[model samples]
Target: EGFLHRWSSARLMGRRSPSQRKRDDCESSGEDFDEDDEDDTENEPDTRKRKGGARRPGGGRRCPCGPTGCQRLVNETGFRLPANPERRLAWLQCWYPPDSVPEKYLEKKQFRVHECHFPADAIELKEFKKSGQVVRSVKKDRLPDVPFAQIRPAATDQPRPARGERQTREAADATRSELDRIREWVQHGVETEDLPQGSMEVLTAALAQGQQERDKHLRTKERLERTEKRLSQILSERDERERALRAEVRAPQAGVRGMNALSYARFCTDRWLKKSMSQWLFFDAVEQLNAYALLLDGYYPLADITFVPRQRAKKTVPPADGERAEMRRARVNYPQNRKPALALTPRDALVFWLFVTRSGMTLSRAGALFHISRGTAASCYVTMTEYQLQILRREFPRLSAQQIRDAIPDRFRKFAKQQGVKSDIGHILDGFEKQFECPRDDEVRAACWSSYKHLYTVKFLLGMLSSGAHYFTSRGNPGSVTDPDQVETSGFLDLLDEGIDTMVDKGFLVQESIQKRGCICWMPPKMRQNQKEATAEEADDTASIARIRIFVEHAVLRIKEWGWFSSRQSLSIQQADLHSDVVFIIAMLSNWRAPLIA
Candidate 1:
């Protein structure tokens, strides 16, 4: 009757067992309810506590303590209680202390906080004062009343910030900042008993493991990309070799089809002889090839870094009438659109490419060594040099004021203490001379001879940044000219802007010219007998300037390491820009070897 009345009549039970009646009678009597003869509900295990002694009533989540006893319950543990009341109650039962004061323990909560940014100098001076140091230089009365990070502000003290305020720190980021150990919890949906007491430590360990796995995945991704790139390069090589083979197969049918018997025999014999040439040892390493070619490592100035020109038809004398007909060109297989004028193994091609940078080598010697014609070698040299000049022309660097600041070294602070930079722009410029070949033309030879060096030579102005990197190289000038004249003629002044300071040797002698452009010049003190010995300050200034200026000379030395440039035979009279181009290329190349400034 009770079940039918509690439920709708249509869903009523027909009868009740004696145990059920007994349980209902015990509940009504407000005593310990027992089901010793009965099992728990169908969903729970039989071993589940069902009665008293810390048992949960009806297997539902409620405080284990009675309502009267639970009024003093407190969330004292340093963890975020579960959102579910039942799970939270269960967690409290296991972790809550049994023998502590009954005072209520309230959980921590976050609240909106306000903060401020202030004149950082105020904070800095205050800290110094607290450390028992007197900073009398910057007076308290004249301090600026503003925040600053970007400027050369006036040399004055900063105003005091408002008293008793907390500074604002950036919001914590889980990815970039360390996780807080307290007042925070791991967000994983874990029950209290399922987690360790020091859950934050656990989370930190897990995050570390996750970071390591992410790094491993990134390394694997990079490795796969490198493998894919190498495979593609190999495929291209295979295709090129196959095309060349096909072209060779069709030679008799195409370029040499109409050759007479004698002409064909001679052609076949010459082809076999050329094919027999083998010189693989010259390019055992790519660096060796670059060194031989007077280039930086793993580079060429060609359209294809490895490709070479194909052999052209040999120049022949006028043929007599009725003579045996000769094939005008060699019969070989190649694609119609092939840009390479000749084909050889990449190694042999690199060998041929490097042959021109050698001094005192004629075209015949190069051809004999590489098994190519003298004309082809000469053509490759001309083409490669032009390409190098073009690339450098387009890609030269023009640094801004901020980059110039970065190029300045912290190591120069010692000098700055003595005499500081008033402006942001700065450079260390100097002139370097390299020997050149005396031209056959007497006028050109006389014009290029340097009285200082007493050798046929050319000079250039090199400017290096403070960070040990080459910034600029002036065009080649006649070595006969003075350093100041070389600098003026090479157009180094055109790059100067207001507030730039150029450091030069005693030879630059362009202080007035630099000052005219509204920039500063730092040069070593002159030692004239008419003048007394340098003062201590002047000596310090010269030493500082010399220390920085030495880097430009070191950069110049790196360029001259190329034997072709260091030796005396590389300069040419035919190409007006040849010496300049070589100087620029090597100066640029030095930037790759070691930075010039820092």
Candidate 2:
């Protein structure tokens, strides 16, 4: 009877199950329950005692029958329980302990409960129909009973055929009908003496057209083959000549190498020189190269760190006169007095360094291409890099506030005025990072790890003028350093004075530091600590500031395009000074390009 009542009530009340009803009641009553804990309670009744050994205070003794004993207690007490088994177990556990309860109920029952079952007549039928006493489901505007005649058509009593077989039969029927119609039409036409004219002439013309297209295709294919063969021959000759040049360079004779050099120069035409110079040497024209070579004239006898001699070992005793005399005699016997002169001039050495810097080629490969030893190549590279860095620093010094104001375009001046930007705005600042190899030491690795890039990197802060020319580039710092900290330590603040405004992106937090130096820092508006987003006015200010400040990032990109910074080899932490000098030189050289904004 209870089961029938439950079924009838569920069907009449929108077909919701008892568990869903219980959940709805709990939600309506504002009773929050831990569903996960209830599921565990049903799976293992003693989960709490097993996991935490926690017992409820002032509760009955632990029941040996586990969940079954608690359920019986709930029935005896006439306590309402949740419909879900898990939730029912959880509710019972709250009232009764694991031990069997010994409570007696005094409340009298108001209604009789009895079991309900189907009659013999109803059970005898193979198909059971819902009794009239039971309620029918009417949710979603659906009928409870559907007639068999309505469900299936009487004319089509057979089961449906497979899709593939059905489609094949339909296609065969269509083709047969179409063929019969055409045959009848032709028979009628023959009886009436009507037939298509010029049929053979149309067929002949189509065949001739196809033949012409085939001939054209054959001619095109033959032409392509001939062109490919000619190109292959040229490539083969070029490879042969390159092999002979390599052989001459490797030979010990200077004359052969000199002749090969002359031949190589002769092959490099003006067009080839222009293209190769811009790509491999970063110079636009031969005249630029000539002018650059002139810059190294006064910096004669450039010193290389690699050539610095090690400290002399302490002599225990003075060399013997006979030993010294024997060394002199041995030196005289060797070819060329055991000392070979340099094969390249100072200008050629400088060009060699630029080639290495622009192409990022390995020192060994560069040395072979230039017909010099690896050690000599290394010495030249180091020497030229050091001298060139010194010259660039002097050439690209930071501009004063007045010079920056003069260089800024008139359009930018008007925009700055409209945007309320100070007239003395000088430089825009931003920072960038270059990825490096992870160090073995934990401290070094942690220090170099960059959260922004999600890799180990070195960071540099760059400052550019409104005209997009870089004026200040900081030495490389650990990637873990923040933008504000890098700016403080990079000595850029020292150049700022009162009335000179410095622009920076939103990442910079150096307003206080810049103010301390008596300079105004113009950074984009940022959301406050308590705010989730900036106001409309603040967003407008940020957009206005970004319009001019983005050029600094563009300038930084130009600096990073150099082969040295973009090379596959990672920067050495041990030689941080050299890497810093390289970055400084590249940043300075980027100024030679046209302005980014213009």
Candidate 3:
């Protein structure tokens, strides 16, 4: 009936379960009977009447045994009652008994009432409610303001267990493993464990190894330093011994005076007096004769001696029968005879010799010095130079007239042939020929020959100076000058001018000029010609002259260094030619002396 009533009420009000309504009615009626019994016997019967419809007579209220009620009773029997059930149960579905605790905690003997108890301040209300006393609301007290230093914060500073104390069974096993690794490092020079598992052991072994290596390195460095010091000491001692030995070796050779005497003697013997004295004397005589020839003749003699036949039949036949006798006579009257030798006197001979020896002498100066007329001096100087050249050929058998002819170039020989030039041998024999056509007066021809020979000498000398070639001589001082006459004559100057002209013609000289007179002369053709209005022909001519003249000048300066050419002496044409050959030989020697350039 309770279940029915509860279900009926639940259905009507949607509030009570069937079991809950039965339990509630039983409690209400039982409470009312108790109240009636205390009040009056008369009310007990009404309570009983009230319960009659739902309750059995003489039996307590029928037990409400629905599935939900039974289950609730079972759950309630398992639950513990709280000290203040009404209040505590309001927010709780279940409670724990005072003795209830985790089994593990209990087994470990760590469980205690104090471990689960609330704070002392929270127990008052709980106790009052459990005793059914009237509870009053109590205001919570405000916490005191605590200083930051006094407050216990989280355990940031807690000391960890020391290595010695961390000895739980598991930790002890790990420690034993670490010990074994250290022992392995000591015994085998390596760690048994990997880096991650035994980082500390690895680090310790590495440090120890590094320390040993450092000690060994330091010892090696000390040994090296000691070795270096010993080596340096030995080297210094050896150097000192060497110096002392050198000083001892040099001691006996230290007299300056003796050394100087030896040096001077060597200089005189080797350089100054190159050959035997006899050779020098012979050369001196030859040199003097050459000067004499230049003094008498205005020009030098022929370089090589030449010989002419003393007598020859005149080429004369009977005139053609038709030719008029008068015409023949007139033609014959034009001096049919040629003088073979030029007229040269004894004084003329001396002057000629002097002139050949000294290249040339001023006419006035010669006259004044020798006490003669200037014209006479000039005449003698010119005539005698040619005569001495002829005499030289006679005296020197090695030199021949044919050789002189051969020395001339083929072109010149051809020209001579075309001109029908005749060689005179005995022109000096006749007074009429000498008086009418004097050989002494032919200065120009003599000068030309003299100049030619001098040019050869200059060329040789120049080659020696420029190239450092050696000039050998039987007399031994090839560089020394013996015949001053060979050099002083204007022969070299004439040759230079001729060379320059030849060079200019060949387009080896260049020049600059605004006008004809303003032209720069003898410049190399390789350089540009700067003649403002020059014709190409004119520039080319000038350039040729410039090229040939430069070499000639260089040759002249080199020969001039020897005192022979520098002195004031006259030279005959013959002496000049001989000197030229000598100079040529020297130049050849010079050429041979130098090493061949790659």
Candidate 4:
């Protein structure tokens, strides 16, 4: 340092010794210094004082101890310097004993780290004589006065933010503070009593609004579904009402009003509206009904009963909301109300009734036949059926063995009468299946589906006298029912005498029950693969039974001549309902007609 000072003083005074004079000559010579190498000398890093700090005239400012801020830190902070001056900036925190009391700090120069460094890792560790636990040395709380630029500002600086931005920043700071507290609690088991302040209300309100919006959309969807259902129901009701009104308006033009041949010819022009004049009036088969109604007089009204043209809607018109129709329609009356307040003569009624029965026409067609609506046709049929049954009930008393035996006509009773044996008179028994209804459910379909008929049907136990007339009909039951069960429940056994002969088909399974009641049931022989051949007597008996049982088929055919029995039914039920009455009426009508076979 003293040599450097002397050199600086001599350079300033322009006085130089011999060694310096030689050095100056060599440095200034062009032979020693190349022109290209001058830039290298200018750009090289120097250990001299930097330019930013306050610089004095003498080379650079000196520290309070001697020259640099580093030297002052070394002297005051008890850090020992290396023996060689070149090694001064190479050491980091290399200090001596700090046991002595601190001396007064120098006011002129501030201490700072020139090149901060740490020790390198050593693979070989030195063992201490102390315990196994390793306690590291701690650092002091305060640091020496260092002249770092961040510690002393060269220029005054202040931040600028908008009002909203400022508030947001403050909120962020508060959140960060809370997070720091939570982190401290997690890491060091530390906690704070109060939560950080921020706007949780705004977030909760926004969430609630979104939830309400979603619920509103859901409610709107449900309401729309309900409205759609109601509209569809209303539309269906409107269509039905329109159809009823149309039928009412068009009913009056259907039938021609007269008994003369001209009126009959005019009505027969459209064959679908009424039966043809040749088939109804000129036909000999149906002419007897008019004579019979005349012969029976007041006892039989089936061929002469009449009904006014009633509007179909009058029966089933929907009541207006909160109010009922003034006249609640009454049910059809049978024997008491056979005659309409105003109607055609008995001859016209007979022609219409026979035409409908023989033609197998629908009730709708029956309505068109006599200038009436469907409702009027239904009422007429219902009343006529009841009246006919009431008359027969009076004429034919409850059947006893003697009466049933006596009912056989000339052809069937001839053999028994000639043989002088009532037991020879036979009653044929069989089951007839009629179309019932369609089932909607899978289970219902399985139950109602008939393996025999290959369709839905209702089964009935039918009996026909040897005279080819219907004797009795057990109420209709499910097609799946066993024939023997119907035989047991029909109460026909009660009317049988000690030796009544009943003929039946092979499928009837009721042969044993008839025998138990002391009645003989003749069924056709059944051939099984393993069974022995039947004797000639069994074969003859089977053939004879089949011949006699065929009359049951004829009787059933006569009943099915009505379209009501032949057409598909709207509902399925057993023998106990209104459907049973319909079957009962059909059986009675079959007996009323001429014998089926001859």
Candidate 5:
């Protein structure tokens, strides 16, 4: 029956389903199968249908190929499961039949064998079966068996008594006792029995002493404050007194104007006017004028006028009889006498001299002093002063003419020379010639005396020792000197030349080499000295020179102090000489009134 059954099952399994048949044919030819055909067959049973419509004689129908079922077999040997039919047949064509059987049955058989091969370990089996029981037993053992009622805290375990409460009660009792003691003490007063009688006395004495010390400190502070106030008051008063004394000392000297007679008066008057002059104008003006006059008289003299002309001229005519006779005749025929025109009234001249004596007074002050207007004063003063200076230079010779030509620089000298013009010395002598005809013998003699006297003044002003009383003892008998004779006999040019050389030799004037040529250089003496010799002594000498040189400056300044020298109109020779004479007189007066040393 087994043989028959196996054979019948193989026969039944040999038949292919309609889809399998189609799939096999398609695989053999490498054709595509319709995917819809597989879907249509999905509901169909996975059973093989035999050919000739016969049923196989098996308990269940199986594939005829058995382990090598024809329906599962692909062409030749191998096979692949079809995909959704399009490339399915092509894919299956490359497959070969399996080399071994599938492991599904083997895996199931091996699992069954594994299960039967060994039982679980005895310990594991026991633990798996008794786990719950053991867990219950452990939970029961870990838990306490005490009754719920016994778990409550005993009444004895509740807070017993607090010692603080007891202590507080005791403290309250003690405090009550203390209060009773305090009340007793308050009612009876603290007993001094514990303290010694001497101690109490000592305490009382200390308290008294402290109170006294405080009182003493208060009194001291009060006294100190009073002393400070007093000191401050004293200081304030002292300061006031000091200020008053200073004011008194520094108060501008009452009417004693010094070198600045006119200017000081004007300044005081102006100051007084600004301060309180509405009520004191006339008084102040008179005071100022009087103060100015006082200063003038103190520093200036009235008998100091000496008239000299700008030029000393000598007449010329041909000599007769013999050469000497002809020369003498020529000399006699020549006009000799010349004098200044417009002589200053003695008062007017004195007023002007006084005005120039003060350092700061100008022509305007002279006008005020003489009651002349400023313009008239200035014009007359300049003209007269210039003429007088010229005359002084001509007659005195020592005073020296201050020619503007001296101010011309060497650069201009070259230009002057190019233009056929001479240097300053030449120009000055030429100008002298044009202004003055010539000097006569008598006039020349007078000039010599005048020059000697003027030289004395210059030496005195320059702080040089005068040739002394012995030399000038007899004013009428001036020593007849060849130098003076030469100056007298020579022309004005000769005198100028001699004067220039003498001044240069005296170190009062300097000559500089300009472009290899000599020219006059006017500078302070100190500036001309050796640099290394500029010591204190040299400085003092320079200062002395500077101080005395102010007289020379003042002589020049006086001419400017009066405004006449700056007149536009040409002055007559006599008037010019008179002006020069005024300058000479003023300069002489300044020297005369200058402070004399014993």
Candidate 6:
């Protein structure tokens, strides 16, 4: 007891422990110790060593002295409090004497000390402890400064329940914590009662703001829920409509329009065909349709109905000179037993194909309209489309240079004269865009996105003669490609002959390319960067180009007039492979219309 008392007194007076004094003496005397010396030191008193036989520092462990017993050590040593509020209070309680410990700190639960650090500025700790002064009493009634806000714990701190349960618990916990904090702040403010004037007004304003924020959050949440409900309802309605339509398609029909020639002719009148011509026939006149059908029948195999004449039963007869008659012998050997059928006649099939092409309707709808199975309709449609496209491709017109010159009206010559150029424009060229569905592929999507159309599109170059006939249509390219790139790649330049002049829109920057091809390109002059407006000569040139180029646009309008191209539902991703063929067909058909220039 006496030795322990003397050691504690020495430590309080800033004197080194006996073990530390001996170690310093050994280090200063240049003495070398072996492993045995370290073993011997473990037996020494006041030697704070761990189980590994390593000596711990003096301040490494928590103080053995109770909170009230070591007040003098804390105040005299000038140690700063811990940064954490709870930790700081517990530390102070451990150091201060029972009478001197603050009353507010006494309410906190006891905290276990894990480790302690010596203050960096405690170099004079021994000097200050040696000349100890009277210790001051800690303020007993002062409140511990608690933060008004805290970050919510991370959700990843523990495994979460289901989504709904987690959300409900988090919201409840947040509300409770906020309310508790506000109540504590109010209590603290009341107890302190030392706030400056106008403090109550600030508190009231803060409370009102918090309330308003909570209400706003609630309103936003409600609005989101309602929007989700409405979207779900819309999806359900769409699904129901689809189901109903499918049921209607599966339903049997007693008799349908346009199933046979008689019904087709009766139901498809000029007025009715006119009303539906753009979507069904491309021609309003029945006579024109019949003529086209007859022309197609010559190429297409087999008629819809064939009348096999019945022969009267004749007695067996042999040819003279022992040579059997060929017709009589074949009739005796082969018998005609195939039955004639009447579901879709060649003319009606042509109309069906046109309807499918123009309307772009599903095969099922076309089959239902014609009182035939979907497979049969598809077969007929494919057959007719191939046959019709083959015939149309051959008939598509092209004007020679001489024909173009002869077709040019007087107005074009007047405009060319005004622009100081010869009135010998052979053809006009322009690019047209058709919107299509966005591609899912990253590279393909980027290629097809058009800044001009502000959509995913495919662009085609159309060439027209002075007479406004669509003489050529280049294959489709991605919309991102420029007009000149399409022109250079689409083989449109191949059609140009030396000395022939071509008119184009201002978008085409193909003057150099055309010059290389031994052809002259006439397009509007662009204003210089430094010049705001075009000069008088440039203005006349632009006006003349516009007048001549207007026909190309009219030709494009005729192509767009097809109901398939005019519909709101643009080209879909599935049709990407066939888009070139379809556009080419449409461009060719546009030439059948009356000449726009004449």
Best by lDDT: 6
Candidate 6 residue lDDT tens string, 107-136? 433322221222223223122476675442
- C-alpha RMSD (angstroms) for model 3: 51.0
Flag the better candidate by lDDT, 1 or 5: 1
Comparing 5 with 6 on lDDT, the higher-scoring candidate is 6
Query: Residue-wise lDDT of candidate 3 within 449-485, one digit each (tens)?
Result: 3232342122221211111222221211121122222
Model 2 CA deviation exceeding 4 Å by range: 1-273, 298-339, 572-575
Report RMSD (Å) for each prediction in the order shown. Answer: 31.8, 25.4, 51.0, 37.7, 50.8, 23.1
lDDT of all predictions = 0.55, 0.63, 0.36, 0.55, 0.37, 0.65
Clashing pairs counted in every model: 17, 5, 69, 1, 35, 2
**Best-performing candidate as measured by TM-score:** 2
Candidate 6 clashes between residue pairs 3 or more apart in a chain or in different chains: 68-97, 68-98
Clashing residue pairs for model 2: 62-98, 62-99, 63-98, 63-99, 63-100
Model 5 misplaced regions, further than 4 Å: 1-346, 356-359, 390-598
Q: 1-598 in candidate 5: lDDT tens per residue?
A: 9999988897687655667777788899999988789767656776654542322454222212222122221222121122234332222222223444333322221111111111222112113465554211112112112222243333354454575554356655664565555446547777645545654554455567679999999999999999999999999999998885454333332232233322324434456533542122212344544543454444443235333224566656644458766656666533344344423443345335434433334545454444444554555555445544444344333323343335333443453365353544222100000112123466543443324333211001111111100000001112222232322233322223222211111232213321123343222355444576677866764554344233333333433333333232222333333433443444443343333212
Cα lDDT tens digits, model 4, 154-206, are 33355534656634677667656655556666577443333233334433444
Candidate 3 deviant stretches above 4 angstroms = 1-348, 351-361, 388-525, 528-551, 557-598
Off-target runs (Cα >4 Å) in candidate 6 are 1-244, 251-279, 298-343, 360-367, 372-379, 397-399
Position 456, candidate 4: lDDT: 76
Ranking by TM-score: 2, 6, 4, 1, 5, 3
Instruction: Determine the backbone clash count of candidate 4.
Output: 1
Of the candidates numbered 3 and 6, which has the greater lDDT value?
6
